[model samples]
Target: MRILYVTTSFPVYSETFLQREARALIKAGVEIEIISLHAGENSFEGYPVIRFNKGSLLKLLYLLPLAFFRRGGALSAIAREMNVRKPASFLNFAENLLGFGAAIVLEKRIRDYAPDIVHCVWASAPAAFGMMAEALTGVRFSTGAHAYDIFEHGGDWLLQEKLKRAALVHVSTDVAADRIRDLCDSGKVKRIRRGLNALPQAREPRETCPSLRIVCVARLVEKKGFPYQLEIYRRLKEAGIDFEAKIIGDGPMEEEIAAGIKGLGLDDRVALTGRLSEEEVLEELQWADLLFHTGVVAASGDRDGLPNVVPEAMASGAVVIGSPVSGVVEAVEDGVTGFVCAPWEPERWVERCVELQVDAELRRRLSKSAREWVEREFVADRNTGYLLECLEVVSG
Candidate 1:
């Protein structure tokens, strides 16, 4: 089957799951083309990509008129859809207009290359574009609702519209699917977990240093709950716990996190290693005794849909400690594969971290179970095979 992937950005370091999914799909003998509204820093590698200019607002304005003329019918249909659901504020109006213009141009580009299915990576702008494309060309489209795409950007009317138009709606976890179902009042959604291509071999009982090495691999963002993790680390330090922490990944919150680090006097105990390549991450995970992945509902209502780092850390034989957010809950069974704690309770997090630090046997037991769980459920080929099954059924 042929699939057209519409996305906000291509080959993002933060969204490697997208690249993995594409690779898995291609390996399964399905034809795929990618179109990113905004280009990314990473190379597109093997896939054929159609990347658009998302640079200057002035340049985008200059192209809007041409886009309108090129696919006027599609733009009008999109405008009507937006008008019914979007707020009437100036910013919202302009944003909708710009989206419509882009969708118009995108629709023209897609018309001649009609594929069996249009799969939107996120249920945000790409899904909007896919909906417009479907309306214009009568082609089938579907979307995967991840975190902010479904919570922060989705609305009652907007989700209803997408649900009605889309062939299938995939969410990463059953908890996320349940939340969106509550909003859209639709039973058409499916749960499809993102999978990892290769997992680190589970560590056997081996002697290590006395100090526990903890690692957290996540973007420095609000939803990631970096500050809470920092607080947990601080409390652990104050309690004279023998541990060192490293936070991987980078984002807009770097400066803020740095300030927090300085203020808490955690410079000696914790380190932030900006963004690292996959190889570097795996190297860090290999030696780490524990992986702390804390997710929270940010002020914008954005949260994680099972942070990819959880399974990565689990497969690496690091005992996982996660927040009680919906997706985290699904991945971590308390005292089983991993431990779950409330984001607000630094004390609780500290206690759990301390337990993992002092008890080597407990850590090994959990690590073994975690790796087994990951191997059983998160193999990329099996998960993407299920995704392909969904696509084939939708295409038919």
Candidate 2:
């Protein structure tokens, strides 16, 4: 079957769920093509990619006037605060007013390709464009809801209409599935957890030292709670705990986080490696004794929908510790696969880290259980198989 996957961006530095899913689909003997806004010149596991030029300059020009005069807040202000809000909202209005002129251009491409199903990754402007293309070409369409799509943009009437018309909808976790059911029909929603590529063989075993090493593989952002993790590290230092920490991702909050690390005198104990390739991440995982992830709901209400890092770390045989937010509880078994801490509690986080560091037997047990859990439930092949099954059923 020919499938057309639509998303906002492609082959970004941070590997997202859609990229992993597309790779898995190709491996599973499915014909897949992806169209997305251009990030850079990179191929996704040899899949065909069509990149659209993002009109950021034009968007900025359009937003400038609205920011100065509009009462409901200008597009510039909204865009500054949220990445998808202004551009998507403004583009949607433009598409509707112009009778889907931009969407018509995409529809021509879709008609030439003649896909059996159009799979959109998020409920944003791209999904709207995909919905229009499907209507024009008579192709079946579906969508996979992520945390930002469901919690941030799902309430838009146009997005809700697309959800109502889709043959099937996929969500990363049961918590997100429940929210989708509230917005649309329960029968149409399916829970398909995100997956990752298989873990590589460890290069070397962790060091046999009293001081344990912990790592957090996430972007430095407000939602990721990197500052809170820093606080936890500071407390660990004060308590004279023997451990090292590494953060392996880059984002907007890098400068602030660097300042924090310097002010707290954790320069020697903590290392901030900007970004690493997938192989590099797995290598670091092999060297680390444990994974410390303190994800929480941001001030803007953006929460976790079961981070892919959790499963990747687990599959790599690292004991996981995460916050008990929306979908994290599903991945972590609380003392079985990993430990769950309360959000924003640095003391609790430090306590868990210290306990796991002190107990070698517990770490071994949790590592074995964690690896088994991911192999059984969260492997990329198994998750994408379920997605393809849903597509077949939906398109029938």
Best by lDDT: 1
Candidate 2: where are CA atoms >4 Å away? 38-42, 54-102, 153-157, 202-209
TM-scores of all candidate predictions against the true structure: 0.90, 0.86
Compose the digit string of candidate 2's lDDT tens values, residues 367-387. 778887887778787889998
Candidate 1, residues 153-216, lDDT tens digits: the string is 4432355566667888888898778877755546668787888888776676334537888899
Model 1, C-alpha of 389: deviation from truth (Å): 1.0
User: What is each predicted model's overall lDDT from 0 to 1?
Assistant: 0.77, 0.73
Q: Indicate the residue-level lDDT of 270 in model 2.
A: 94
Whole-structure CA lDDT of model 1: 0.77
Clashing pairs in 1: none
lDDT of 2: 0.73
Candidate 2 at 286: error in angstroms? 1.1
lDDT of 2 at 214: 85
